[model samples]
Target chain A: MSNATKSVPDAEGRFGEFGRRFVPETLMEALDQLHEEYLRSKADPDFQSQLDHLLKTYVGRPSPLYFAERLTEHAGGAKIYFKREDLNHTGAHKINNTIGQALLTLRMGKKRVIAETGAGQHGVASATACARFGLDCVVYMGEEDIRRQKLNVFLMRNMGAEVRSVTSGSRTLRDAINEAMRDWMASVDTTHYILGSAVGPHPFPMIVRDFQSVIGSEARQQCLDETGQLPNEVIACVGGGSNAAGMFYPFVEDYDVSLTGVEAGGRGTQPGDHASPLTYGSKGVLHGSFSYVMQDEDGQTQDVHSISAGLDYPGVGPEHSYWKESGRVQYTVATDDEALEMFQLVAKLEGILPAVESSHAVAHAVKAAQKRSPDEIVVVCLSGRGDKDISEVARLTGIEM
Target chain B: MDSRISAVFASLKEQNQMAFMPFITAGDPDLAATQQVIRTLGASNVDMIEIGFPYSDPIADGPVIQASYTRALESKVSVSQIFKALGELDHEELPPLVAMVSFAIVFRTGVDQFLSSCVESGISGLIIPDLPGDEAAEVFEKVKGAGLDLIQLVAPTSPRERVRKILKSCSGFVYCIAVAGTTGERERVADSLLDQLKWLREETDLPLAVGFGISKPDHVEPLRGLADGVIIGSAIVRRFQELADKTLSSEDLQKELTKLAGDMVTATHTK
Candidate 1:
């Protein structure tokens, strides 16, 4: 299927068997109204142009596809490339999707934007986007995450977004999502749920992937121009699998490009020790879609452990599920220990301290490069920088500096 | 004897019938009154009881439940107190009691220790709202060993593949979150989601129990034929809140609960 056509939602706003408005009855009217507004805006060229302008001028669109020469030489094999999403204005690839959704929320005549954040990356991005659009923004974060990711909380507040610390459940991403959803349900009249990842219910995944496709679209052309051919393989870490979905979309049709998703393996498969849903999870429903999830036999969501806060989730994007079932892409796990070692290795070798979330991809790339030939090329999406992870990494590795 | 949860399902299949279930947050207004409410519900021929373990911040719960939680916490109801009170229930007299709690409470208590205590305290099942299926394996194994059911919630937002996976791991009954939002009272459950419930029923032999926003009697009426049971929470709690007065005698509270339960049971049978 054509990338654009594959990415767009169907008439009912679903992707394959995924994506439906399964909200409460009180909010059903609001969701229908939202669906109507989204449809109207989708056809409006002016709306699309405004969103595109923000993405390019405000969020720094067309992020670089830099060749990681030093790391490639150190690995002593395949040439490695990095999609510089860290160069985005908000310091992560999340801004691209946030800017698009925030614009849509405004066009729909919504006055407030509500979002759930884990590790605060998505919250910060949403806050930044809302601020730029002059929209009222409220972000829900797990109380524990608020304590750990204080910097992000500060940044979000500085951007003038109201930060609500969710103390229920594990006090993590899932709890934050639950709280944000409750707020949206109550205030659906004037609010938009700016889902962070390529998850939630149906239209969210489809919409997020569409906004982030710029990553893959840009990287694909850059690769072709650099090597006169597609890269041999592409690697990205999968949390809710947004960045990976974005980077993999343009390349899915390329039969020659091998796509690999690196899931956080935490310490190991010991109970309560990892977030590698695809590697360890069975097919289950979560966040409004059916896909692989880390759950117990009774189908209760399990507490997912990961070194990277962003990748600490039990479910992934639905499109990833489709791609996974179709055998179009491969999935693997990278342990916290392995990811940590790679995080340090890349920092020392390439001077790039990637976000712990992106280090999983770096870990896999290091292993894959060792097996591939020098002529082979492996492009890893360096989704975000590691400045946010310095304290956690130090505590994890016992490195004071 | 009124059918135990297991026997209720067995008889339902034999008679080509379904069971009625109603959920209420324990200690919503006051401890004594809430206990009476539970006893009343048990006597009403309800299939099973879902007793919410009130947390300070119940993220998955809406405003009604949040208010109930505030009242419960104000009453100083600790997890220990909940177990102690449940331990007082005559096992033969009370219906099967399942604890619906958030993960924070369980994690703080320690998963293994909590399951062991639950088994000892006469709790037959647990529905931890925040625990994802994959991460629940170890806890599931422990709960299974202790002969307790670890119930799973399947939300409207859940994908089909997820439903199958959750069904495979689930025990007791499968909880279908009829709506996307948290627990609260609603006028009606959407007809479209009923089809999703039907889809889950075909995927597993386990009895399907629908919850979330099931406040009124009419909400459970339609599910009588399609689902194995129905669960209600916020509406019952609201009833207790309305009745709570410093001077109300225990007998008076029990009478109120009995009246509410009788009305609910009558609605279920008639609808």
Candidate 2:
């Protein structure tokens, strides 16, 4: 990959016309303040040093880039590599952004931090950061998600954070985001909202993508060190496309390397049955930015289903939408059964229990490998561990663990 | 610049009365009931009507208004359906109609298409709470070309300079959020409301309409001379929710809305 260059987003936090501030007037000043602080911090060496220290020591950064020999042999084609973000402190890439935002919260002199989560990975990560820094934390989670991700809820509560169950709308990530936005509007004076992904209004999408850029940077360097060349393709699963954006942003300027984003195909390509926004959606504003979203003709968001709770969102990140439009990233989908098959295949062959979300990427990588020559290499971002999903998988397969 | 909204405010000013604007979620009880709600408010003494365009996610709304969106969605109401229902109403009977929709609803249907639909359905103005200041400049031209007023919001936290910039592009009337929070009922209006209104009055001559927590008739007394209008939303939606819970008839809901509308208009006569 070429040396770092700041990508498409302009000064106004726009990737073409996709990213803009569509929030209430009350939150405008706060967004401006955040944007200013972030720009200043981005250039400060001290801020970078401190953040790098925490990422390495506290969150256990520099996660491995492991070559999957068995998987490569099974596909009988390209060499497969896995960016092991599942080994992070909270078992997911979510800790990367939370650590950065929590530090920013302190810099802004805010005493409290709030966030919204779907599968509770972000909630746990945010709570962990707040607990480490001795700050107050509150996470809004959908009631349905709280039921499915009970273990993550317990982890968050154990870290001295308050978990509020949101019951409105579809009772999922979308509703939790609504509740969190309302909370921020009411308490913008003393609190900072730590958005979970590479989405939301201006500065947030840019900020999150920056924090997560570490993934792409580290993987790019590791792949060069190990193979003496850049990987042929970089792949990651896209919920709101944070991990994928993080893993792909650094490689975007590298024209030779391909970028593929896998979305949850759930049951099929039907709108309501799948969460593949980029595959089958129209351009509409959702969660405060214009992106590809599954909406009706009148602009109401449609309910999305996925075996992986983390990918059950109706919209993709604005930058991802832009990349897809520019033909930089080839987007694809993996169904529930395909992801489950990959999950079992990875666990049995590599002794790694991949999260269902990450399994989507594995499913696609396996297919891509079958189509490529043996000299080519593909890197799949292993976003999170599957311990939290073991029971759900067990129930689906009707097996006693 | 003279539109139905400005004309309504001008007529109210001549009568020495404050404009009473009542808000209701379209398709709350169903498309048929929503039609009745609009017609009921029209027959009342209110000066203008604000129809809440139901979106699946309304982040600017509190529990009462949020519940209304869910109920509206459950009834399978769409933006097209709301416009269809509004097309059936007689334009002569209704006051100037403003649709309080989200930006997504308009962008999804294509802005020009949405504005043209509003014109065909007799919608006089639009209030997108999510479209903050200066950002609306992009679509301001298209809105003007369609002869529809694009209402702008002025928050309590807005700086004086920001308020000036917003008013430069604002039309119909300025929506002054009574509090810094989402729409819901509050026991008392903020003490700084009068100062905020005074500051806004110095910025532009556009008629000011205070909303977002102005839920009761008594809330209008303090703003009688300070603002041109007061918008009551969540309180009215809460009343409809209570009736729906009890399985009451549409006529019962309309009757209650009429009484509340009358009481609010009476409160506008504090002088």
Give the number of the best model, judged by lDDT: 2
Question: After best superposition, candidate 1 residue B107: deviation in angstroms?
Answer: 25
Worst 10 residues of 2 chain B by lDDT: B243-252
> How does each model score on lDDT?
0.79, 0.91
Error of 1 at B136 (Å): 27
The RMSD (Cα, Å) of candidate 2 is 1.7
lDDT of 1 by residue, A1-401 (tens): 32322544566555555444333333444555666776677788997888787778888887888899999988889999999998898789999889888888877888899999999999999999888889999999989999999999999999999999887656789878778878876677688999989876556787788788889999999999988888999999999999999999888888678999999999988658999888888665565555677765434567789999999998888788777767778999999988888889888988888888999999999888989999999999999988999999888778788
- How far does residue A284 in candidate 1 sit from its true spot (Å)? 1.3
Deviation from native of the Cα of residue A179 in model 2, angstroms: 0.5
Per-candidate count of clashing residue pairs (backbone under 3 Å): 22, 0
Off by over 4 Å in 1: A1-23, B1-22, B25-39, B42-60, B63-232, B235-256, B259-271
Candidate 2 overall lDDT versus native: 0.91
Candidate 2 residue-wise lDDT, A41-62, digit = tens: 9999999999999999998989
